[model samples]
Target: MDEWLKAGLDYVPRWIDYQVQHFAQPGCAIAVAHQGEVVLEAAFGTADLSTGEALTPRHRFRVASHSKTFTAAGILKLKERGLLRLDDGVGNFVPGLHPDIASVTVQQLLSHSGGLVRDGADAGQFTNHRPFLSTAELKADLVLAPPYGAAERFKYSNHGYGLLGLIIEAVTGEPYTTWIMREIVRAAGLTETAADIGLMTGGTLARGHSTRLPLGRRLVIPGDNLTNDVASATGFVSTAGDLVRFFSQLSPMSEAGLLSPLSRRDMTRGHWPDSESVLDRSYGLGIISGTLKGWDWFGHSGSFPGTLSRTAVFPAQGLAISVLTNAIDGPAQLWVDGIAQILKAFHAGGAPHEEVADWVGRWWMLWGAVDLVPIGGKVFASPTALTPPLAEMSEIQVTGRDAGKVIRASGFFSPGEAVARLRDGRGEVSEIRLGGTRLVSQSAFADELVARYQGFSKDRA
Candidate 1:
């Protein structure tokens, strides 16, 4: 790895720790792949909060909606084999009675442009109010009129995908889960992935945590509610590592992968804008394509009850990253973006500017130590829990001898505080204080505290 890459990799663990600890998440897992190899894998916090079980990398998460990507691949695989075409109408093979729903082409279903109902009107199963739909229930839901006409606009439909699973069964004469596991998943080198909960055996599945409501805590439980035919739509389980590996192969740059270059390009190329509000996001066949940090990327996000996930593949960088969280409101997207930021900063980080040379030091107080670093004349607070890392030391004009007011600090409650570098008789910095939180030199911290106590005692008398 290049120095920047190495530096970025080294920082990943610390960042994960910071996010899990400070953000009040149950825990999260991450996997990053560069040039087709897994580089960093980590798990932080407890997987099973009730039992206080620490999460491990091997734990599986209910990668809901990511199943769409796999199912889409199966459809494409069939197309490649000349069994079906993207333009084939759903009504032909499945023998459906609804002309409107049947008239929709296969491609539209894959791209979520089929205008099918997203979830049945009674989707209480998702909220655990009722059991998940069976094949018969799914069929009953499919007969309902679509919310809109075909190719009307981008409309996400789990029902659309569940129909595709029926079509897959019609064409292949086998179960959707079995066919996909044999063809798409196993072929892609994922031994840990499964289509639904029942299929998930032998390994530990990451217990899905409940969402922290307005004033509630997240708890661990079974998050995979989608079963039976719906498994093809929103039911899948995977590790962050497997997710990255699978998406990396979807990049056209891969010499040999699950799909042909033509198929990969067709799948990643944006077909329709995701919404009127989103300019950068669009849907391809089973894939969500968007831009990050100005680089085009394509992948999918999974949102189970207690899990949130996001994956992105930057073909230019030959890189893929996946962040999986067992909590209901995991910052998977932000953390994924944060990783990209780290990589970007590492490459941008060069020699420090002259103005920052004097600012480099470890200042301390009773609370903890704060390391001031100047980068290219700009000071940044590193990641810390105690105080905001002085991210940007703006308006650094001196206020007094051996003391200056840091007009800005980065942590909560530390900003706009008077930061003074107190000097000893020898003109050395004895300690520093950001507001009332006195941070002393390491060697002098205890003595400084003792002296302050003694002085306070005398003043009281």
Candidate 2:
């Protein structure tokens, strides 16, 4: 394991333990992939409090709206095959719903701007059914409203994606579940991911749970009395391993391969700024697009009766992280944010290439009594023993076993040879050597090197 990652893994359990005590959660699971490698996979606590079954990587959990990305991918596949255009109206597929709804297009549904009311009124009808929903049957509950804001502005609609499910059925002449399974799920090699709420398939699927009822939320699953009728809109179950693979196929900006590169790019192109009221996160084809923790991240969150889940993909770094917890509220959200922070610290150094650091802020680090302040492109440190603060013109010498550079008024150092190597983006220090101990640390020499150079830059802002 990378030393920093090892340390992070150690910290994860500590955090998870705190969560279980505070939230009364049964258990939590986390998976992280970096450079296409599974760096961290762990389960904390029990899967079932009553039986004392421990959680495992193979446990399945209902990912709630995380299913939207899959449904969106199926729609994109239909578009890829030239069967439909995203701009095509809903009236083009299901002829049964309000014919006036023709104005709402596939693109609008994927972007959640179609202004279709949620399936709130007759949702109980589907909940009582065992078979996969037919296109017309699914549309029986939807109601249409005027476009929310000139079309393509963010207004999240589960009903809008339900319409896309209808379109998928129309284009393939197959059930929505069948089409998604054969086309996107199978092709993506996600043998463990599926929408088969009726059949209870997907061998590694985690059992969905809920805090609302001690018996857990009842849903329609195949071969078992358990299944939730919310399939098309929010009824898919997956393991973190499968979700990691699912995200691996897409770019940071949007879905690709499932749709034409042009369409994929277009879908990811933010149609609405995140600042708009009621829509703080913009939509992209089958993905959510936003900047988080100084990285361009895209993905969605999911929630169900007993499960809350989230997955984030940092495309620029070719990394993806996901967390699933089978309690109403658990440590999953914190785990997601912590993973992002760990990645930020890991890749803190090196000159910017494809990514800009305009959003990365200064971070604090301490090695024994040496206090490091990362600001304006430099890591500045001062000794308490110094008679007075080093004057602005004072030449601060760099010291260490290795020959490193010195900041005129700041005691930051960059190994003279390592700096040139990092400048070329070839050499990256993966561990920190501190106090004669090679202890694993998040802030290594690279971060300090980057800040040191920035401190000497002509502009300090």
Candidate 3:
């Protein structure tokens, strides 16, 4: 591994673990791949809060809406085999459809520009108020005319992907799940993936949890319901490790990939802007794309009732990252972006030398925690609460064995102030002093709080 990548990977797990504890999230899983090889796989917190089952990298998550990417790949694979074309009308394959919806081509549906209904009028299936729609119910909903014209703009529609599922069934004389599993998922060399919950076998499935606001406490949600007909849109289950592996192969720069270079380019090209949103993102064929830190990336995000997940592939950097969180309000997107920021910072700073290597540790104060991270021979005092911890960070220039000076920081922070590491009887660093404020180990801080504020000894408390 490159020294810069190694430096970033070394701190990613520590940062994520801190975030999980500080935010009280159910659990989070993360995986990263570089040049088609997985370099890191990690998980934090519990899979089921009721049982306290520790989340592991092997645990599977209901990666809803990522199923659309798989469905799009299946359609493109058929096109590669001369079985279908991107411009073919849906009405040609599926017999019954509203004229407007039927005229929507396969490419439009892939790009979410088909302007089909977002979901049928009664979308109780998503909320667990009712089971997922069956074939009969889905067909009944498709009979109605779409609210917008085909190719009007980027209007998201789960029903459009469902229609693509029916089209897959029509093109091949097999079920959507069966064909997609064999051709797309397996062809991409993924083992920890399934088209739907019913087909998921082996490995532990992480149970989802609701947010703690309205309920005052999290309740376990068994996210194992089967999506009957809409499985092609919102029914795929996978691990963070497998998700990165699968998405890495979708990069156009990848030499050995499932699709041809032309198909991959067309699929990932930003075709329609999300004009209604302020995110400055665009929708591609089965892909969502944007620029971060001057690097263009393409991937997908998924939202199930109890889970939120995201993945991003940076073709220029040859990197793919996936984050899975087993809670409705999990900050999966923020976590992924933060990881990218950390990597970019490390890449710019290079590797740390032995002089500052021992300066690494997470120290706490009354307000929150601060992480002393060593990168490129300098120490960075970063706050634990921030999504990208390096934001507004203080740079320390080590002057001696146990002394440093804060050379760069915000105006409110102690810039150009003396910093020192206090040692215990055994000569181990026990506390740190940044200017006038003192920070101690987490355990010591907790004990101090109980003893001073609560008026009780550690054992008594």
lDDT winner = 3
Q: lDDT per prediction?
A: 0.79, 0.59, 0.92
Worst 10 residues of 1 by lDDT: 386-395
Model 2, which residues run further than 4 Å from truth?
A: 1-14, 122-137, 143-153, 202-230, 252-260, 274-280, 349-461
Model 1: per-residue Cα lDDT over 1-461, one tens digit each: 66557656766666667767767898899998998899999999988888888898899999888999999989999999999999999998777436799899999999999889888989876676887678888878778788899999999988898888888998999999999999999999998889998888667878888777865777566775657778998889999999999999989898756999999999998999967763479999999888865778899998877789999898887789899999878888778877776665555663345544465455656554555544444444443443222233343334554445555555555666566667789987666665676665556766777777988888899
Better of 1 and 2 by TM-score: 1
Q: Clashing residue pairs, candidate 3?
A: none
- Decide which is better by TM-score, 1 or 3: 3
Rank list by TM-score: 3, 1, 2
Q: In candidate 3, what are the lDDT values of residues 10-42, reduced to their tens digit?
A: 999999999998889999999999998999999
For residue 94, give model 1's deviation from the true position in Å: 1.6
The regions of model 3 sitting more than 4 angstroms off are 456-461
The per-candidate count of clashes, in order, stands at 9, 23, 0
lDDT of 3 at 61: 98
